[model samples]
Target: MKKYNLYCIVLFLFIGAQAKAQYLQDYTGRPYYLKTNDGVQGNPLLTETWYTATVDFANGKTANAILNYNLRGDELLFKNPKDSAVLAFVEPVKSFSIKGIRLEESDQADITFASGFPAVDDQTNKTFYQVVGDGKIKLLRYYKKKVLESTEFSSQIVSRTLVTSNSYYLFANNQMVKIKPSQKTVLAAMNDKADKMQEYLKANKVDFKSDVALAKLFGYYNSL
Candidate 1:
């Protein structure tokens, strides 16, 4: 309930900013100016509601604000503290943490994201990846969002919608490898400790389908 209230407050701020038109931006930052009724069909953000977050900039500065991740543009945006204006970082963030439950089973744990990994498969060091499991061996989830166009039959109007497909990876020993949330792929990535991984798998009933489960598996593997 408290989280929902926070969302409402943040929404009100942004909504008020939109009314000014003078405050909302497009082109200066990666975000396209957000419109409550842009004729666009879907949300561009990971969450339409803003979150209370602490953003760590590349310059080593930090700030607290109501923010959201623009999945379509792959940008982190925050609302101005003063005018409630929507803003984006001149520099991409090194990392950030939002206060809320990202995964249902996380028990209201704060979710964090970080960048700086080597580029692979069209992703750069600046591309933020959700910090699922960390330590020597880390698990990350890259949410790839794309814009899709659709038109209803007998309607000349076309609609653009934002959709995301997520991919997972394991980073260790200065290397990052793409992975699927399956025991086979996970074991293949961590082949060095297959036997130990098998032992852990047997001891804990891990449903690879669950992000939390995969994270727990990687956490244990990293502990080894």
Candidate 2:
């Protein structure tokens, strides 16, 4: 019996080590970014600061590293201390969290502003989204990137501008629903308690035009 128990413990340890080995095997080093000399003004990254991030890969392995995300290219870059190499994380990362940043969305006349969101799913497509809130209902912000070209007046120099469009989503009952940043749309998304929420908004004088206000409304709805 003593020998049998010792064998079982060894098997368990081997399995645990294999799991970790498989997780680390998924990561491969790639070029950080293609060199670019364009003098365009806009950048997809919200800030230039590198943040400590915890990345969960699709293979059920997680690693903690200092990371930065390029919004325009939809790329995740990591600096590995072992080799001191700035390499792009080529594995399919299921989700990652960076410190001191929260994904937020705002709408202008014809444009939407999104920041601090990294794509968690659909890794092959290079689509990026961040989870702003999660509960019975999950709030996701999707980011779409576009390049705009302009010519200078004097030198006729062509420049490329990176623009991003952000769309908000509400996930309930395993269905993803798109939402506009407005009172009507938000209430519609919360159809379960639309009437009551509408009343709450009125009583509280909520400004649906504001993204922060709209997110707060969703947060409250999820709580209830």
Candidate 3:
């Protein structure tokens, strides 16, 4: 009986390890090629340098990779940990988290992303939003990049530059409430304790425009 129990335990451990297999071959896209235009001044991705990431594929597969977010493409791009070739999993990703993604220099926390939020503006349920803070109430941030082109009529030479922007949403009780990072919008979204947030901000001086500041604000709200 003891020998049978030991065999069962070993089988269970083996099954657990298989469940977490990388399954990198299932990635559904071709080798990624950067769509670089001549005279472009900035990168099209959130960070030019890749960071370690864990991706959850739509088919219940997961993998660890060296990855970056392509803001212009609105997709997550990753390369096999064993190779330098970049790739994209064209099949939708269920969710993902990248270690030390550096959304802002002041914010060092590992960033997590999720989809399936209600469609707002151009963003659909599949659009990935950065989750800020913790608890049942979450602040979601959607980062966007736009390209501006300029030309000199004499030379007719064109140059493009990428600019990034952030949009915030408050998710609570099965809803996504769009908001600015101001005291009013924040307090209104989390109106249960608007007074406390106001008082806290008066003493704390949270910078409304900063991503880290907005995250800290939601963190404080969740604590309440």
The Cα local distance difference test for each model comes to 0.76, 0.65, 0.77
Model 3, position 108, has a per-residue lDDT of 42
Candidate numbers, best TM-score first, in rank order: 3, 1, 2
Question: Which runs in model 1 stand beyond 4 Å of their true positions?
Answer: 1-32, 35-39, 102-109, 151-157
TM-score of every model versus the real structure: 0.75, 0.66, 0.77
Expressed as tens digits, the lDDT of each residue in 139-201 for candidate 1 is: 888886676798889999888876677788889888889977687888887788899999998
lDDT of 2 by residue, 1-224 (tens): 99999999999999999977865565566867533565666665633666677777766777776666676676777777567576887777777776555444443212222223333343333454566555677666676556788888887788888776767776667666777656676676678988778778878877765655555677788888
Tens-digit per-residue lDDT, 81-116, candidate 3 = 556778877767878898766665337467888887
Most accurate candidate by lDDT? 3
True-structure lDDT of candidate 1: 0.76
Best by TM-score: 3
Q: What is the Cα-based TM-score of model 1?
A: 0.75
Query: Cα deviation in Å at residue 114, candidate 1?
Result: 0.6
Candidate 2 displacement at residue 136 in angstroms: 3.9
Compared to the true structure, candidate 3 yields what TM-score?
A: 0.77
